[model samples]
Target: MDSRGLIIGMIILLQTTVGILGNFFLLSHYLILYYHECSLKTTDLILKHLTMANTLIILSKGVSHIMTAFGLKEFISEIGCRFSLYVQRVGRSMSIGSTCILSVFQAITISPRSSDWKGLKTKAPKYIGLFLSLCWILYLIVNIIFPIYLLNKKVKSQNMTKAKSFEYCSPGDRDGIMDSLYMALFVFPEVLFSVLILWSNGFMVVILYRHKKQVQHIHSTNVSFRASPESRASCTILILVSFFLTFYTLSSILNACIAFLNSPSWWLVNINNIISMCFPSFGTLVLMNNAPTFSRFCFIWIRNKKSPNFKVAM
Candidate 1:
C-alpha cells in the first residue's frame, strides 16, 4: 500500500522469478554434464557443482524469504528452522568454497607450461571430487550443532534487542568461538580468490592485446577471434566474479545503512534485507546466460555438428 510495501513486493517478485529460472537452468546443466561425455571436463564439473550449490542456497533462503514476505514467519516449526538453517549455511558456504577454488583453478590453468602451475592441471581434475567431499564434510560438522542448540518451536517475540535473536548456539559457549572462527576462515580465502580472479583476468587481457598486435604485424585481412574456449571459460569465470563482487558490495553498503539507521521501522528493515537477496538472484541468471560462447558451442554440437567455428575449428 505504501512505497516501502511496493518496494518489498517488487523485490520478492524479482527474486522468486530469478530463483525459479536459475534453478531450472542449473538442473539443465546437471543433466547435460551427466549425459554428455564430452562435457565431463574438470572446469565443467566445477561449474556444475557451483551451480548446484548456488541453487540450494537460493532455494533455502528464497523460500524462507517468500514465506516471510507473505506474513508466514512460522511456516516451518523449530526443527524445520534448524534443518533449514543448517542446509542454508552449508549450501552458502559451499558456494563460496567452489567459487574460491574456481578462481585458483583458472589461474593455474592459464599459467605457462614452464611454470609450476602447469603440472597442477593434471592433479586438479583428479582432486575435484576430493575437494567437494571435504567441503561437504567440513561444513556439515561445523553446522551440526546448530539444530542441537538454537531451534525451538516455542516462538519468541521479536524484541528490540539483538540479544534475543534466535540462535542455535550460545554466544558464551565454544559454539560461539567456532562461529567466529568459521567467519574468519572464509575471509582470507574469499579475498585470495577475488584477487586471483582479478589477476588472471588482467593477464588474459594483456595477452589478448599482444596477440592482436602480432596478428596485425602479419597484415592479416580477415578479423580473427583469438580466444579459445578455455580462454572463453576464463571470461565466464570473470563474469561470475563480477557478479559476486557487485552484490557483495551492494549488500555490504545496505547492511551498514541498516546498522547505522538504527530505526525500529519494521517495513524499512524488511525491505532492506530483501533487497540484499533479490539482486544476487537476478545476477545468477545474468552470469549464467552471459556464456554466449559456451552456448553457441553447445548449440552447434548438440545439433550433431563437428564444429561450431565459422572461420576455424571449435
Candidate 2:
C-alpha cells in the first residue's frame, strides 16, 4: 500500500477497534443491569437500541473502508456489498430515529407537573416497543432499494460516474423517478425527526432554566446548583443529537460534492467514511461519561486499586 492508503487503513483500524470496544462495554453494562433487574427503564431500552445500531454502523462502515484501504476489496461479493450497505443504511436510520425518540421521551419525562405533555411520562414506556418496531419497519422499507440495485463491479477509474460507488461495489442503477422517490421518503422522515429532536431539547432547556430560577428564588442563600438526573440526561441526549447532526451534515456535503465532481479525490472518500463513523465511535464514550452506574462502577474499581479514599464527584 502507498503511504496514503497505509495511513487511512491505520485510522480505520483505530476507529473500528475503539468504537467496537466502547459500544461493547455499553451493551454489556446494560445487559447486566437488565439481567439483575428483569426490567429496563424507558431510557435504558432506547439506549440499548442505539448501542446496537451504533455497533452495526461501525462494523459495516469500518470493515468496508478497511478492506478498500488494504486492497482486499475483491473479497467482498455482490451479496456482501448489498448486505453491508443495507445494514449500514438501516443502522444509520435507526440511530437517528432512536435518538429522536430518546430526546422526546426525556423531554416528556422532565416536563413540568402542569405542562401539557406531562401525562405522557406515565404512558411513554408502554409504547417504546411500538415506536422501535415502527422505526425498524420504516427504515427497512425505505432502504430495501439497496439490495435491488447494488452490484459488485470494479471501477477502473475515479470519475464522477463511479464516485458514488463503494470500493467493492458499483453504484446502484439510478432512475430519476426512483431517486426522487427515495430522496423524498428518506428526507421527509429525517427532517421530521430532526425538528422533533430540536423541539424536545429546546423545551427541556427552557424547563431547566425556569427550574434554576425557581430554586434561586426559593433559597436565596448558599443554594447548591447541582443538575438533576433529568437535566443531565437531557444534556447528554442533546450532545449526542448535536454530534450526530454535525457529522451527518458534513458527510452529506462531501457526498454531494463527490457526486458532482468529475474526478473526486481518493482522500475525500476516506475522509467521508471516517466522518460517517465518528458519531458511533465517539458517541459511545460520551454516553459512558453520563451513565451513573457505569461511571460509578469504574470509579469504585479504580479508587479501590489506587486510593482508598478517592471519591467520585458526580
Candidate 3:
C-alpha cells in the first residue's frame, strides 16, 4: 500500500481501539453503578445510552474503514455489508437523538424551581426510557432501505451499472427523485436534533451566565454562593457539545464532498474516516477528565493502594 494508505490505516486502528475501550469503560461503569449502588440517576442513564451508541458507531464504521485503509476490499459478504450499514446509520441517529435529549433535559434540570418546566423535569426521566426505545425502533425501520438496496461489492461486480460503491458494498442506483427522497428521509431527523441541541445549549449558557452574575452579587455582599456540581456538569456539557459540533460539522462537509464528487478522492475518504471517529474515540476521555464520579473513584483507589492494611481493616 502507499504511504498515505498506511498512515490512514494506523490512524483508524488507533481511533477504533481507543473508542471501543473508552466507551466500554463508560458503559461498564454504569453497570457497576447499578449493581453496586443499587440505582442510577436519569442523567447517568442518558449518558450510558450515548456511550453505547458511540460504541456502535465506532465499531460499524471503524471495521470497514480499517480494512479499506489497508486495501482489504470486499472483506465481507453481502449480508455483512447490510448489517454494517444498517447498524452504523442507526447508531449515528441514536447518538444524535440521545445528545439532544441529554442537553434538553439538563437545561430543564438546571432551570429555576419556579419556572414553567419545574414539574416536568422531575417527571421527564420516567418516560424518556420508553421514548428512546420508540426512537430506536423508528430509526431501524427508517434505514431498512440499506439492506434492500445494498449488495457486497464483490457479489455483483458486473451488474452494478448505476450504483454508488463503497469500499465493500454497492448500493442500488439513485435517480434524482430517489436521491431527494432518501435525503429527506435521513436528513430530517438530523436537522431536527441539531436544532434542539442548539436551542437547549443556548438556554443552558444563558442560565449559567445569570447564575454567575448572581454569585458575583452575593460575593459583593459578603455572602458566598458556591457553584453547584450540576452547574459544573452543565459547563462540561457545553464544552463537550462544542467539541462534538466542531468534529461533526467537519465530518459532514467531508461526506458532502464525497457525495458530490464524480469519483471521490481516496485521501478525502480517509480523512473523513478519521474525522468521523474523532469524537467517539476521545470524547470519553474528555468526560472522565472532568467528571466527578471518575475522580472520586480514582481518589478512593489511590487511597486504598497507599494503605497497606486497608484490606485487613475491611
Candidate 4:
C-alpha cells in the first residue's frame, strides 16, 4: 500500500523465488543420490530428513509469498492454516534437531582415544531411526497447542482490534507463552548444540594446523587429501551456522524495532517473513552443493525420459 511496503514486498518476492528454486534443485539432487547410493546409514538418513524439512519450509515460504503479494490475511482455510503451521514448525524443529545430531555424530567419528561417544559411532547408524522418531514425538507433543491456540481465525476483543471492524487471529495471542517455551525448548538446545559443533570444529582445525606444520618441517609440499573431506564438511557447517546466526540476529533486531515503535509497519511484516525462511533455504543450498554428482545423474534421467527411443542395429 505504501512505498516501504512495496519495497519490502519486492525484496521478499525476489528472495523467496531464489530460495525456492535453489532448494528444489538441491532436494532433487539428494533424493536421487540417496536412492543411487543406497547407504541407509545414519548420515544419509539425517540428510534425507533435513531435505524433507527444507522442502516443507519451501512450501510454507511459497504460500506466504502469495499471501503477501495479494495483501491477503488468513490466506488458507482454518484446517489448512492449522496444518500449514504445524508442518512448518515441525519441519523447522526437525531441521535443527537433525543438524545437531549430525554434528555430534561427526564429532564422535573423529574423536581420538577413548571417549564415551566414540564407541557409539559403530552403532550410530542403527539409532538414527530412533533418534528421528524421538525428535518427531517430542516436537509434536510440545506444539499441540500451537494449532489450536494460534492458527484458526477467531474473534478478538475490541481491545485487540486495529480498526474495530472485524475479527482476525491476533499474532500475539501465543506470544508470551509460546515465546518463552520456544526459547526453552528449541533455542536453548540450539545454542548448546551449536557450541558443541564449534568446539568439535576447533579440534579438527587444530589437528589440521599441526598436520600441516609436520609436513612443512619435512620440506614436503604435497597437499594432504586426507583432510579435505573433513575440512570441507567443517567449512560447510561453519557457513550454515553463520547464515542461521545472521538471520536470527536480524529478525531479533527487526522485532525489537517494531516493539520500540509500538506498531508494526507493513515492511516489517514482509521482512519478517523473508528472514524467517532464510535458514531452511540456506541449509537446502549447502546440502545440494554437497551432492553435485547426483544432480547430473538426475538431469540425465529426465532428459532420457523425454527422448525418443531408438532400436539397436544388429
- Candidate with more favorable, higher TM-score: 3 or 4: 3
- Candidate 4 stretches greater than 4 Å from native: 113-117, 151-157, 162-170, 175-184, 201-204, 211-226, 252-261, 290-314
Instruction: Show the colliding residue pairs in model 3.
Output: none
Could you tell me every candidate's TM-score relative to the true structure? 0.76, 0.86, 0.88, 0.75
* lDDT tens digits, residue span 166-200, model 4: 11122444457767877897678767766776676
Q: Local distance difference test, per candidate?
A: 0.62, 0.80, 0.80, 0.63
Tens-digit lDDT track for model 2 on 1-314?
79989998999889999999999998987786676567778898999999999998888888988899888978888688788888888998899889899988988988888877767878888999788988888888878775664343333444434445454453544557656766787777888988898898788889888888877765645765677787777778778878878887898888878767656678877888889889888888888876676887655555665986764353
**Winner on lDDT (1 vs 4):** 4
Give stretches of model 1 more than 4 Å off: 1-3, 152-219, 253-275, 278-280, 293-314
* TM-score of decoy 3: 0.88
- Which residues of candidate 3, in runs, are more than 4 Å off? 151-166, 170-172, 176-178, 220-226, 298-314
Give candidate 1's whole-model lDDT.
0.62
lDDT of 1 by residue, 144-178 (tens): 76565554323344532453222221121224545
Better by TM-score, candidate 4 or 2: 2
lDDT of each residue in 1-314, candidate 3, tens digit only: 99988998999999999999999888877886676566778888888888888998899889988888888876887688678888888888888888889899889999989899989988997988888889888888987875765442244546554344354443445467547757788777687888889999999999999888877756755675667899989988887777787888898888778777767766777788789899888888888877888767656556766986664222
